[model samples]
Target: MNENKLKSLTEALTELASAERYEAELILKADPDTVIAQTVAAVRRSFALDIEKLLTEMGFLDPTTPEKCRQSAEAGT
Candidate 1:
């Protein structure tokens, strides 16, 4: 992967860790169904997507491979 992409992935991972920590803290101090908790969950999900995109761009992840495998399996290939 390029330097910039690697940096981005690292930043995303850091942010995800922070969000997870905050989410855990919130869960311990407040109700899990609270709006803030839900928002943190959403933020975590967004960070996961960002990480996935970076990995895909770095050629570390093949997003289409799973779909292709599924299709081939259905076709008995």
Candidate 2:
């Protein structure tokens, strides 16, 4: 995977948030869980990580292991 591309998604997400806060509020209020799921899925697919690839990386899903591409986000911190 192109690590730089994955990093770009994060940068884009930040810029999009600043530019479209109202739209984001609507999407979140509609269905919080589904919105979060879709956004994460989009990020993964954006980096070309399909269902099989995602499952393969499931083992590294932990906070202590920061090397994993997928990260757990904490809000209102």
Candidate 3:
């Protein structure tokens, strides 16, 4: 995803988290599995992209070497 979209989504989630909850009784009417899956996907998309972009900029990844990338990850790069 582009940086602008990523930033917008991040801000939106932050605001929503602090806002008062909507009527949970209405949301609870949906399938529990669907709700959980959607929530997980939303969180993962923004968080994963943000971390991946930052790490890539820091040169911790070796594009041509899987082992190098694994080592960097292990070493907490």
Give the best candidate by TM-score. Answer: 1
lDDT for each residue of candidate 1 in 16-68, tens digit (9 for 90 to 100): 67877776777667765666646766767766677677677777789896578
TM-scores of the models, in the given order? Answer: 0.49, 0.27, 0.32
Q: After superposition, how far is residue 72 of candidate 3 from its true place, in Å?
A: 20
Report, for every candidate in turn, its global Cα lDDT versus the true structure.
Answer: 0.74, 0.52, 0.56
Pairing residues by index, what is the TM-score of model 2?
0.27
**Model 3: residues with Cα > 4 Å off, grouped in runs:** 1-36, 63-77
Q: List the residue pairs that clash in candidate 3.
A: none
Model 1: worst 10 consecutive residues (lDDT sum): 31-40
lDDT of 1: 0.74
Residue-level lDDT of model 2, residues 25-68, one tens digit each, is 67788898869777655544544433233334443234344333
